[model samples]
Target: MSEDPDLFSAISSQNQTLSTISPERLTSDQATFELERLATLIRHYDRLYHDQDSPAISDGEYDALVLRNRLIEQNFPNLTRPDSPSKRIGTRATSRLPKIAHSIAMLSLDNGFSDKDVGDFLDRIRRFLRLGAQEPVALTVEPKIDGLSCSLRYEKGRLTQAVTRGDGIIGEDVTPNVRVINDIPETLAGSTWPEVVEIRGEVYMTKAAFSDLNQRQSEENGKLFANPRNAAAGSLRQLDPNITARRSLRFLAHGWGEISDFPADTQYGMMQAIKSYGLPVSDLLLCCHSLDEMLQHYHKIEAHRADMDFDIDGVVYKIDRLDWQSRLGFSARAPRFALAHKFPAEKAQTTLLDIDIQVGRTGVLTPVAKLEAVTVGGVVVTSATLHNADEIKRLAVRPGDRVLIQRAGDVIPQIVENLTPEVNREDWHFPSTCPVCHSLAKREEGESAWRCTGGLICPAQRVERLRHFVSRTAFDIEGLGLTHIESFFADKLIVTPADIFRLHKRRDTLINREGWAEVSVNNLLAAIENRRVISLDRFLYALGIRHIGVVTARDFARQYHEWDAFSKMIGQLKSMRNILLPSLIETEEKYRKRVAKELTGFVNIPNIGNKIIQSLIAFFSESHNQSVVDDLLLEIEVKSVHFQQQSSPLAGEVIVFTGSLETLSREEAKRQAETLGAKVAASVSRKTSFVVCGKAAGSKLSKAEALSIPVIDEMKWQKIVKNNGHISVKTE
Candidate 1:
């Protein structure tokens, strides 16, 4: 990314840790932060991979982040962001190319890195079909070619258009560029084909072709590609067909989209039909009868992956019958019937040069290991995450020692093993003071992070908070970014959020600054002014409170419609926390520990946990934080949230959904509940009005029964929703 790892990478390792933890074990604040951090990092990496055609991380490393994000969203559905990666395929297509909207959207496949993940995938498929464990499902196993996804539209057996898989729905039209590729035919070989069909496949460059092209570019002083995949993508998106013709780009048909008629019932048969129609198909593809055979094929392809002319990242397995795929259907993000079994991260050995500490938004000091420049997969590696002091100590890594590093799935690469750990040398010293602010950095009990106690006074923390305030999901002020925030903060021109709004007044001063012109300064001011009126939830989230992320902020906003009401509850919470009479303090402390008890009615909201309460209290209770909020409030208006419906039975009720929802996807259920003015919570509690049960209903079901909360089955929920679009509000 955008912010670079130096600013946000420190927070990334914690995100990985959070990803591994069960959602139930995570505090509301922790989940919120992890989700927010993951969303940011994923978007950043996606832009790097899609928009720039320069991937900083390997495919395995990238897939790992997406998988973690998927898991986190699965657990905390309500907390999912508007900018969630699950909502789209890739970054937006470049403006240079003409755009095309696919007749049927191009979707991604869910990935599996291990045998257990693949086994679980099979189990889920069997569970969905209500098949016995012994059932042998036919699957089409093929190499997942590491290339740009392309869709070629054929009309009357002739190639009419070609499109890139840009953000799934819309794509860049690369018809002219694709026509230059020798592997892609101008017309179908056979007359018997659908009048209108979109053949989907991968656009790739062979290893030999890529090497020759790079050598030619090197001699010509032209832009060199990082790898074959990038070379293929860059070549295929060229505006001029002649430029594309000069590059040896190749194609392989895997599937079809928007077909006028079905040519075959099975995926294997469909591939054969596509190949018969003049498109090339992979010879390595095999029709497997069971999961074991499918896995064996995956290893078979991986073992000889180096021998392949083009790059293949993984093996993709899809249900054989097209009818089975249709029945299995699509999940919120990807096709449930398919999964890509990815290769593990590539490993390499390098000497640890030095350990550098970077402070995060929350003041946690994260150690990054500097390494002698090395290549893992296609990306160059110079640094890897040391994670925390405990990890560094566990590895006993010292400068100049050789370490085995693995390409990480998360944001930062990680040191897997210190190869020279036993070598006699002085141990690398872990700093006890903040590197930037020189404040005391203390490691809390039972915590991995060593945090600086400098609080708001720390320049690093202040800059980061300001950066978050203008983040895409927050105030979302256009034209203002991390670099601008850093520059303005360093110059003391924008020390706070209030200062950002006042930038218009500093137009002359800003115009005089380096890299800023009068037009740019004016544009920045215009963007800031546009955000003068923001939604209550966005404004609350922008405050950078410990636990109050977008979802939690929305929860609090729904609990109290206006900022005035929210502030009143904050005052009440402060009062409860500040009771100092010696005898009453002991009694009050024990009473205040109850999360379900209404200190203010806001505390009793379902899914609102004790940590959330503590964070809100701790945030507003601080004089500096309150002062900042007061200053920010003076510069903007916080708009109240609106609910469209109020008469539905679920209206304003906290409903908990458990297990696998077949009739309604988890996202669909939450959308309908919210549309009916209901709150969808992740867990069951005394405050939960009802629990909607689906197949394989879990502990939440038992908890709801124990609390005597109303339990509505999937059919009941669907019936209630289908009846005149709503049902009367009721508990019984």
Candidate 2:
């Protein structure tokens, strides 16, 4: 974890070896060990960057770790650990607010860091739909706001619930907090609105607001948040709604979630509808028909990012047509039809004053660089993370050496490179022991980070884990803030997560404690009691496993459906790992095959991989982790996931559209096709049941003719889509 020279050398050498070594050169044990180490390191970094919002590495450096992990996994799929960082999305929902399950999951978008990446994303859509290169794919481009995501559910045109995008599937209810934001409409303007609709958008603080808020915090001796995104999240997640109301929080609608009925069929049209309903929508939204136009819009947005009142990290490009969106479907974590193209990282040069090692809640040691003050992207950079020993060695940075610092998407600053390295100095070495507790800190084989052997005994780790346990996606007990958790932990009033459920037993003592008023204590107890009957997903997420995030936890919940069943299966897997079958009962080859077969089932779970399977098996294999699960199960009920599938007429049919329609727009035509129980594809393929060719039908028409697929004109298409003879068409 030291930013010292010796650690850097170790990392540099290790990375070089990894890069040069072929998959065939590695033994099964070597690959397995490397995969485990990479998984651990990546998971630790993911938590630091995503959950805590205090990233210790640059995006490029992080991407390298992910790339390394991926390469290893690709080479040795069977060696992949169950807890591999690749299987998860953003960090677990670890906030203080109560968790609310989203009616429709609010997924993240895959990133397109370059023009080629964006082009590939579009090309992917084309390939998935069997579309020709020349076919037009209308896309809606908008600024990807670098702010907190919020989902606003409106019933009868009145805003009822507002939730943060905690983990996509579930979020923390912030209805009261958001109700006071001026940008959000209290009621829709139109009478002809859906019975239920969830408007999804970003909750942000203007640059002015962020500056003003930070100034006030400094004056009041309050903790200053890192950036506008952090400040906005803190303000919106305030326990007291009045506090949130006082903050200058703004919201801008971009998309939606669950709806009783959609007002429009295209993304642009939907945005217009949302704006007409009195919701604030971004004026930067543009509809682009070609990849060049999308890239142009992206560059324009990037140029304006610094000038805008609010912060934006990138430009989002989504398939314009709703029917296309539905047909394109989604990946485990993101929509396949949408992408986020991030702005380039901004860099500046500064002297490296010193290197500091900081240990996180999970015991992973991180190296930070103390830098001479330098301006970067309008902010004065004093310090940046070295990431690990390897990053330091990679840059060959030393005290007094000039180094390049980068800030991208307003994320944590990182030392990108060393500008000066000729000055002679002794090599710095990372400590072999934990600085705080004097516990043995060891870097496992093939790992980048050094971790303290101390578990619950380490105060920092203990406090952090407890905080995560009560986070919004976990137990979500109100009033048990980090401050309270620290105080309770220090006093030995609580230790393990199970102790949270037993807090009511400490009522008499807690009531008499300092800063514990009767009303507050009662409310805290009530919050605890309210969450006694929790869902299986939340319960699993509360455990703070290395890589079991909200989405993965939901996957587990859905797959197993019940606590007893999951626990039993995990136990069986654990037994299988520990026991060795006799050759008489079953041949060694057969036993190995059986083990692989069982693991494949776990790995095949959508989004679940060998890394996660290994992590799960390793966790269950441990007596203490199992005990924690057993104890937690005794304290609460784990509800099963009940899926209610909606039936649609376009359930199985795949239809394609070509040319311009006279009566309906391309998007509307696709929507009508979907409404009539058809999947509107981008091109005519063997799977296509019918192709609607309108005026000036192009390559698709020819392809459909060649394939002998049924081809119909606009009038015939309208006749087939109408439910009861006449079609209801909206004029442009």
- Which numbered prediction scores highest in TM-score against the true structure? 1
Q: Which pairs clash (backbone N, Cα, C closer than 3 Å) in model 1?
A: none
| lDDT by residue (tens digit), candidate 1, 343-436 | 8888899999988887766777778888899988667888887777888898999889889987644455688887883755678889999998
Model 2 TM-score on a 0 to 1 scale = 0.53
Q: Rate the local accuracy (lDDT) of all candidates.
A: 0.80, 0.73
Distance from true position, residue 688, model 1, in Å?
Answer: 7.0
What's the residue-level lDDT of 280 in candidate 2? 90
- Model 1, stretches more than 4 Å misplaced? 1-78, 177-182, 186-192, 212-223, 421-429, 504-508, 514-517, 577-602, 643-732
Top model by lDDT, which number? 1
User: Model 2 Cα displacement at 407 (Å)?
Assistant: 1.6
lDDT of 1 at 563: 93
The 10-residue segment with the lowest total lDDT in model 1? 1-10
